[model samples]
Target: METLRHIVLFVHLIGFAVLFGAWAVQAFGGKREFTRLMSIGMSIAAVAGLVLAAPWGLPDGAEMNYAKIGTKLVILLVIGALLGIGTARQKRGEKIAPAVFWLVGILTATNAGIAAIW
Candidate 1:
């Protein structure tokens, strides 16, 4: 249904927000809060993304635009991976370079904007 699709889309977007916000918070605050918030948010976001990717029977063709959506998904995955690395590093009491966080945040925002249009 159209409504279901929209709801799924909304949830997916929220996931991205969680991820982006987590990284931003980490960038500003110290590792303590960063680790806590980022972990929780990323978990929720990843689950929501999985839910949104379900194969619902609609037209069966490109629900949105595969190429654009694919690009956005790729970017998100890359950011997610980077965040995961950051988390791992944090666990070892090592701080990742701040620029990495900034870059991830910027890329996430850009992907979100692209997703909005495409």
Candidate 2:
């Protein structure tokens, strides 16, 4: 069980990497649209995080931090939704503002910040 938890944690980190890379490519490479990978990776990370909090991974007497977990979950949901919508809009031949992409990056970074510091 412990080993499985670690594996999930690793996958969670990989998801983060994919998201980060996606943003980097757009921000630096001058792309105006998000790839499907960005939304997919964000989802993978969010799900893995929840999996990490499964009861089997906790100490025998430890209680999960529901507040923090809930906050992160909500933030991730927003990120995923925003990216998904943005991608869809772009696919329809509509131009999405660069600021929207930047906002996604900001929200994602905020999620990372909260996760690391909280």
Candidate of highest lDDT? 2
Worst lDDT run of 10 residues, candidate 2, spans: 52-61
| Lowest lDDT block of 10, candidate 1 | 30-39
lDDT of 1 by residue, 1-118 (tens): 8578678767776767776777777667745224555556666665666656666635657564567756866876777787788768877888787776677778878877886675
- Give per-residue lDDT, candidate 2, residue 58: 60
Candidate 2 lDDT for residue 42: 90
> What CA RMSD would you report for each candidate?
3.0, 1.4
lDDT of 2 by residue, 2-118 (tens): 688889989998888899788878788866588878877897898899887677766578887788888888888888878878888988988777778888888888888887898
Model 2 — TM-score against the truth? 0.90
Clashing pairs in 1: none
